[model samples]
Target: MSDRQRSDTVHYDGPAGGWGSLRGITRIFGKEWNSPAVLETLARQNKPGGFMCTSCAWTKPANHNPLEFCENGAKATLWELTTRRCTPEFFGKHTVTEMLDWTDYDLEQQGRLTHPLRYDHATDRYVPCSWDEAFAAIGRELKALHPDEAVFYSSGRASLETAYLYALFARLYGTNNLPDSSNMCHETTSVALKKVIGAPVGTCVFDDFSHCDAIFFFGQNTGSNSPRFLHPLQEAVKRGCKIVTFNPVREKGLIAMVNPQSPTEMLTGQETQISCAYLQVKPGGDIAALMGLCKHVLEKDDEAKLEDRSVLDRTFIAEHTTGFAAFEQKVRDTSWDEIEQNSGLTRRALKDAGQVYVEAERTIGIYGMGLTQQVHGFENVAMFVNLLLMKGNIGREGTGISPVRGHSNVQGQRTVGIAEKPELVPLDKLAQMYGFEPPRNKGLNTVDACEGILAGKVKAFIGLGGNFVRAIPEKEAMEEAWRRMRLTVQIATKLNRSHLINGEVAYLLPCLGRSEEDLQASGPQTVTMEDSLSCVHGSIGKRSPASEHLLSELAIVAGMAKATLPPNPNVTWDEWVGDYGKVRDRIEETYPDQFAQFNERMFTPGGFYRGNSARDRVWKTESGKAEFTAPKHLSATGFADAPGRYRLITLRSNDQFNTTVYGYSDRLRGIEGTRNVLLINPDEIKRMGLESGQMVGLETDAEDGRTRRIYGLAVTPFDLPDGAVAGYYPELNVLVPLSHHDVQSKTPASKAVPVRILV
Candidate 1:
């Protein structure tokens, strides 16, 4: 390893979530974030049988404490429940053109949207409009267009109830162009897992963390992204589990973590070691790393067999899985030189990591966007699952495949029917339940949606709750395409770049947030969300609403449906909106098997787990057994290729969640005050003849005849493999082309881009 590269005391040296995290928390909820009501509001957050955290969709531990929310979760709650306001007066003071100049953090800091707004061409500002008037106008535009011309985008933060209604409305209005945040982040995980495990979600739940003897974290950072995961990691370390981590960047969370929730540890200033072994694989080399482990395991199994001993679970393999012979042969056939160079790890290191896996009886493989945003994202996940299946490590206590979802309820949105591919959702059942034949055509994911918009094929776009333009790749193209739409509607709690980058006619409708109470015609209401582990529970907001004019996401969807649809008797949007329980009832009717006793389960403790047949070793696949799939390649790109170009992987800073920027300082990697810098290995910087703090231009290496570049980015020498670089996303979003994505899932390959540095 290279000597320690310092950024002049910028890097945080303390364990994650110590006094530093407490100070960070105080900074946010106190004067810095300026959300005084957060602590009182957070008192109800993640409490037993209370509302869930508005942040990442990590599954909560059973018997959660009164203050179970993490520091980031507190920031999210403050962001939602802040006393700040963005009313008509705020808009009157600033033009849409002016607001476009503000940073994402500044724009959101302007605070919660308080009233409905419509784009005014005459004044170049958003003028206040009545909710009914805006809804009717949007309905008129949507009704006039062909259903195929309308694109409905969903966000992960939207509750399952709201998402279900949005899908219903889109189908009733006649379209399946249901693109969403999931399409951008975890579509690869969903696609690959479904093909191999019969279920598209994680097989293991929160309980696995307590029992697993070995856990492999491939490209996931538990500290900044999923902070709640630190508790389990700390526990696993205490129990002496082998936590092997494979990531391109050395995330602080993966190295060490101090659980802020632990009073004893906090008082003593002690920290727990997270990873027993950290393998710094190159960008997009996750498949190579997994396959290397597979190769070592196969060799060990072969040796054990010759000695009349057994290392592989031969009985579990023969009884529950198929295609092992082919999987094993492929691993053996792959050259070690190719694996070593691609993975940026030695054969001995991989063998040592595999030894830990072989020694542990119960192992869990977990991954995040680091693997999923690559060109081989789907295959990347499949490779990990393939390794776990070799030992029959799934379908038992403490062992299975888990995709650490980037957003809360991203998986649930799919479970409750926010899918681009129509087959994932029950089209026949939706039609039967709603008295309308749902659109059978496969819809657009994020990439396809952008293409459609650019081509002028999509006339209208309705986003349930997301900054689609900012979260997706190809920012310049997306911004231009966003302006091409005839009509645009954003259901949001606050303003984002998307609200300004609008169509001919754009409307921003304010809605009740997760931390606020929602009162409807029936009375107080509760919305449900499904966590990453597939536990469905209710989230009821009891805090005061941000604005009196604010409506629930359910009401807004229902109002839009009422305005657009032609009085359908079978499904009454207005009636359902009056009482959220009706929506749950409808959900139960449509998905009887999955949502069995839906309303009843909401009151049950810890909600209810939507059981995965794959976890029970019951393969719902056509073969009636778990099937192994060989990856298309061991690595997305090869070494000794693309000379003078660095493999760039865009990632989020510790200061942000998805596209929401909480602050400019990223304490995780020691990035402070700006999101404009790029972290490159010192070797690359030296080779390029660039100074450590030199400003450089980045141009994408693409097959297409177009130049995409983000210039004037400050480069900092950091801890990463040679010929690799890391930069915050949405800034380098232009470097990722619209066409560059996973073929099967159409997810943008934001994490893997080949770019050359310019001084």
Candidate 2:
């Protein structure tokens, strides 16, 4: 049978309260108590002096109960603590070709790697290699290449210390090719926030959700993407806060949620309403919807401001902002007809949303990749900033902009200077602190790195935790480039797609997972991580190492540094590797303000938080105050001349997390045993004369005449708006060309692609 037929062998979508819910309940209870892995993982969750949850970026209260983990968090924990092991003997029996043929789920589920393995081209198999030999080979190859030819990639799962050290090593080696996971997801948010607010971080904290009178949620699926966010949403609803959601699909959690935390609600099976108003906006139409709301508010402010203090903060705007007059003029000049046609929303609906914001005393706006992964993503965010500034919602108790970052430490990695284009001031500071002139040349981001590889300008690649190939867009081009590199080094816990696509010399170096203890020469060492909320905390693993031969990410970096960099009299790379405290000392010396008390703070339960823009209201703009930005006339995703094509938005299943597939089922979406289904509106399917559950092919409508297609997909009728559809990511990333990326951020517009469906 074909893969699609095998996937469809099982299908069941009964009521969630029956055996389905019982299975889920059994999985949760059984995994926690009966399974040894679950018990060990639960011990780490929210424990005092332990690491922050590595699953999601949500931050909890400083002193929460010991079991403050979410459902996905439990999944991640169990996955890490699995008993299966992929040892060198296992690799000895399987060839790279054979391994590549296996599905991603099977490849990862084979288990954690036990030792470093080097791929042999002659045998087409990977063989075990000692740490010393692997380091020497990598160093030799890297030293042979010019600094510009080497690329370093970091994942969001990497600890702050590992990322900082990796940056230092890359700079020391004289290269800035640091393409990271951020480049693929939220690079647009960072780029836009910096231009408008002078800071790339969000301006809201967990506490801000409690105080907000209303929140405008755009393109964010809180239930699956960040389940921990549901608790706060529940609390906000209890406090009578209005939630307005705008998305292509109606997410279940956004409309009504059964709070598992509430004993009364849980026992009675009661559900609480979440979104006061849910608008089904077309895919890639976020800019138009947002602009329409801004226009509505500006046009009616004169009459509406009579009773609503939230309509406009005249005092704050006059003192702390500029460019409002220009922004207001642009909103006034914008026509409602254009907004309605582009946003696919009626003028009345837009006005109703505007009125909510106008009446609420305090309001916050939260967005996700749906808004960020677009050609005009940067401008889309700037438009939101304009709206917030117009209403003076920023730097207040209950109002601000919150960009829901995906990775656990994505924000933190950027915080400690992990940028391809490091500012001159930070470079100068590092030079002064480390006694060496830092490289001033700009570095390569994800897109730039891929270009370099394809052009043969990049020779070496180093990945610090992540499946680089699958995580990036333009998979075919990226895979081809990976094969052309002189050397590829992966510091990961398990085998991934990146490991299969090798270069002349490729090494898969197994490392300690987040749940495993890290022992250096000095003894057990602990690392620190920063959550989305800007809170820094210590993470010390209690579980034994997955393999005795596996090394910590820090050690691997140090080993590579020893082999690659020339003897530097100022920096003691050996000493830092010997004792993790020495690394902390270096961090303190480098970024004293951020890493002060790095050694002593770990002992404190729940490590200290860093400085945040929301707490102090310190606008770091050129004018020393927040500024209103004018909206540029641009569509969210640029339209192609696809006469009969619809824009398709790609998302993740509830069982998947950034290329790591836990299972093939998406329980909440009623999908079972398959990830190859296309979600379409019933009207659109009927218009096209396509039946639900029929196999269909999707082709991209690109100007280059490139035929990007995914065939044999079952169509599931959903409540999607016309001209919009949904599919899984990475699978659909093939349709998104590398050239079709956000202009300012270079982030692939994966969430917005024009395609034609055929049965």
Candidate 3:
């Protein structure tokens, strides 16, 4: 049956967490892993001595409760600890062509991959292959092409040791095409922050959550993305902290939440209200909304000056910041009519929200992909820094910017040198340590890599983890282009669509998951990961490997490096694989400033903080001061509105993490059974003369002349803005044009696509 036939929707007015979350956790555990290993896994999650939670990058608190895992964290743990396995026998029964017809959820539910397999073009199937044979074949394929022709991709799931080795391997091979998960999610934050605050990562650590008196959330849904963060929000609320949110949809997490760990709250069905003010701004309207807040604050600062009261931190501005005059002029020049029209918020509402910022002595600004995945994503983030700068809400305790990272170690991967730009990494240090001059030319990013593949410029692809073909925009085009590549290798724990889309020479290398023990020749090895807050902690797998044939990611990467390169006397790939500590030591030599005493500090009780210079009022910018950016216009997205077009925002359901679909339910949004649905505002539905459950189709208003469309989707009314619509990602990724992205960062504008409904 088709997805539309089985799909249905319901009205869910209940709070985000309560019994609903408990039931979801119970269902996943019973479905995937009903063994005592689940409990053991939960106990180890987010602990310094245990495995980092693979669900999200939210950090663990220093003083934590015994049961620190959230409902989604439990689900992610169970998912990795499933009993089911995808063996060679399973692959023999189904050909690659046949599996292409399966759903993403069905493909993943087949469980963890247990053996290495090589694709056979004649049989159109994957067959069992020895490690030596696969390695030799991949080496042959890679050696046939220039180093520049190969694109090395790493997922956010990879540990620091694995990622460090992966980056070194690529640089040794004389190429810098290292595109990763951040390319699509938070590259805008990295690019924008590097120019504004001279740091590419968030300034707030987990401890900052407790000392802040107020927080402003922009385009962030803490419940669905990082459920573990709700605990801090719950405590902050109890302490009477003011939380304000500006998003297109009134996210359930921002509205109210019930802590599943609390017996009194869970048993009594009590919920804590999360946000004091939730402003439902229009889709892609975050820039205008942020500007409106800044305008109100600027005007308030003027009034405060008259009364001899301190509103703006004029002292901090004069001593540590630059371009304030131009930034202030831009804010004052922006009329309220433009701000209200673009932001879909009233002057009164924005002023009230600004008043909260004005009153709070210390405040934290938090955001997610909603603000970073737009046409003006870079400007959107820079504007937020501007707002915080005006109030001097940075470089001090309890005051900074927090970007909620989606992947567990995406930030870590970037820190360890998974970047396309050569200037981002320390090439001189790498050359001195590795005895090789690294390539200096800028390499292909995610979008650039896709374009290169389609143009026959990039011939080989190696993925450390993740479903690249499925996660990126222009899915169909990427799939077709991927097939033409000379070689493709995926090092993963589970099966996904990217594996089925085989190239001329494809190898599926099964690797141990983070929760599985990596017993190397030396002994049981431990890998470390950096969380969203920049804490680098150790992760020791608690469970045994799913199969004896499975290898650690470090081993696989080292094997490829050994086979691909003709004996390099300078690098010892085998030694690093035998004991991961050797890898950490080399990492220390390369980045002594940050990774000093790397092995010793990584396993510390709460892990060591990778200090942020911005937090200490030290600016690394060229001007030696924090820079303020003023955009040329107030539009968040450059797209002009049309009669039948609506701003489309793609999001994730609670059941999915990134492109990995776990089930067919979005419990928080009241969607179940299928993902083939579109959420529209009730007013928009009425104005369009459409019914609530009307089956409809959508076509992109991209004007690219490529007919991007989806069919047989049910239109469900939701509490979204009138001119906006929302749908699940990956499925809706087709509507996202390849060329539509943030011009500065080159990150895809997944959150903002313009489409028209066809009844």
Candidate 4:
């Protein structure tokens, strides 16, 4: 039996990130971090010479506390810098067949990969292979096929340097089949914001939190996902700023926050309340809730006119916006009954929430995956922008859209260069600079890549970083397609489940972690990363390599470029590999307007913000002015109201970050020892004659007429909306069909999956 089996249940009645966090950190990284070398590297984290924490993308403050790290940051850092080694000897001892039995957490915890590895069919194991041989083999396969047959995938953890090189390599090789992690998380934010505001990124910075009048958190749990982000919220509360939240569950983080770093608070077991008002809406109802607020605002504005009061920002709308009349008309025309039914909130409750908004001069709207992982993801984002436009909440301090991203540098990857579509910028400019005609054809995204692989249209898939297989939905379908690929390559640091689920030919190219030194011909180099607020800064690793065999992500990209395009003297792949400054120089040369003083400015403390024109009130769209959209997304709450049906909201636990499970328990939600449990409404459980902790199975209510079932899941009755049940993901990913996605942004509709539970 395993530790998970021994610990069937646990009760947690504690605040978020206090003593519980200290216990978690000590439990995970206490032993190995006592050493001198590891301690030195830990000291360098989030300081002047240190790299950014590999956890969340919450921007580092200009003047941060000496202990400037969170519990999850420590977990991520120590997990990467662990002394345990997964070498050829370890591979010889444990075959690929044996690895399939290990849990996802246990698989990654086995240790770091030390060298390049290739799967051997006869031995049923991965055998050590030389880097040269591995690169040569991949190059041969890539060169053998049409460029469209290859898919170059990326993860958010990759730095700007590696991402740029990967994009250049793919375009030179003649394909834009570059699917990245952004497609799954914040793509809708980008798409919707671009259509309305001419920039996909946010308009606010860290300082905005301090100056904002009121802050609204929609479908986001900040305390658990990004604990450090709570600092601003706590401070905002202290200064009398109202903080409001909307979500399906009453998340512990939003309810209260306790910083583990504070000794007095930790000793006294006290926590600070974060959200002044929390509205618990049903799953997939963000748009309806937003619309309800909008409807109330319009009604108040109409009444304000009769009372000779200023409710709307008439000057800003007249000068800076278009389509507001139509947008206002649509909101006014929407029925209160439909809004109430879809939002799971009374009209009175919505009016109360809208009163807070009406009273504030400036408000900031913040959201997470809960808003973007639905069928109306783009519409959800658009509605928030619409709400802001009505109040003139953007292009000013303490007011704008803030989508809290997951990875440390997810925003940077796209800003530098990583996308399936190649026409985001000028192709002629890129061709003139790089001396290559970039592919104008559209290529595979995350979903399309899986489809291409299933149909045997994709011959090779190379991941720069990330557990591509586990992060995506449609687990069974992806597993089959993943195995059918002629060649699959992963450039990663730790051993993920994606490595175990092998292709016909698979290779694991172990790379250095964020804290490890990257030495090239130009001496040690520092990689840059962009945070959620668009601040680009240098990340210089302060630790030695875990294994001497490790290669940097920059080196890996350069090696691939050299292998695929030989006799290409002008590209300078060999020279650039030795000194990464050359790569930055080229990046500056390519995107001169945005990154003019790239190398010089990054060395400065705290770096600089990559300025967004939208922040300066310059709209770069066709209209040359900010536009308001009447989005097509309405309430999806009716889909789950049918008999014997529930809407499954796929989420991550407090102990987990994305697909990387730190532990089997969620301390915030009172879960322990296993991921195979569901949180349902207690009232519904009684009505259905079902007892808590009983076994149940779920089948997706998909439109394709195919039943997708996941069985033997343990159920836990709790306080949830009537038709909603919550479950942790990658474990329950089978219920989310690949085809079920947002029509506008193509993001997976993980939060809107209508499922039937078998009692």
Best by lDDT: 3
**How much is the lDDT of residue 313 in candidate 2?**
78
lDDT of 2 by residue, 633-748 (tens): 53688774355788889988767778887777677676778888888877777888988899998988887865678897898887677788888876787788878788899998
Instruction: Provide the TM-score for each candidate, comma-separated.
Output: 0.97, 0.94, 0.98, 0.96
Q: How much is 531 displaced in model 2, in angstroms?
A: 1.0
The models' CA-based lDDT, in order, is 0.84, 0.79, 0.88, 0.82
Clashing residue pairs in candidate 3, if any? Answer: none
Kindly state the number of residue pairs that clash in model 1: 1
Find the number of clashing residue pairs for candidate 4: 1
Backbone clashes for every candidate come to 1, 0, 0, 1
| Model 4 C-alpha lDDT versus the unseen true structure | 0.82
Poorest 10 consecutive residues of model 1 by lDDT? 1-10
At residue 743, give the lDDT of candidate 4: 74
Model 1 Cα shift for residue 29 (angstroms): 1.1
Q: Per-residue alpha-carbon lDDT of model 1 for 1-759, expressed as tens digits?
A: 222325442466877887778877777776434344556667767765677887898886667766788878888887787768899998899999998889889899888899999999789899999988998998899889999999889888888899999888888888889888888988888888888878888898888888999999988877889888887888888988889988888888888777777788889988787888888898888888998999988889889989998888889999998888888878888999989988988999899999999899999998988888878888898888889998899999999998888677777888888887888888898877767788899887788888999999999999888888887777887788778789999999989998998899899999998878888889989888888888887888878888899998888988888889898789877788888999999889888888988888874556579889999999877688888877768776432357887888888888888889988768878888888888887766777787867788898887688788888788887788877888887778888888888767878888778887766
Please give, for residues 312-348, the per-residue lDDT of candidate 3 as tens digits. Answer: 8999999999999999999989999999998988988
Ranking by lDDT: 3, 1, 4, 2
Cα RMSD of all models vs. native, in order, equals: 1.8, 4.2, 3.3, 3.7
> lDDT, candidate 1, residue 449?
84
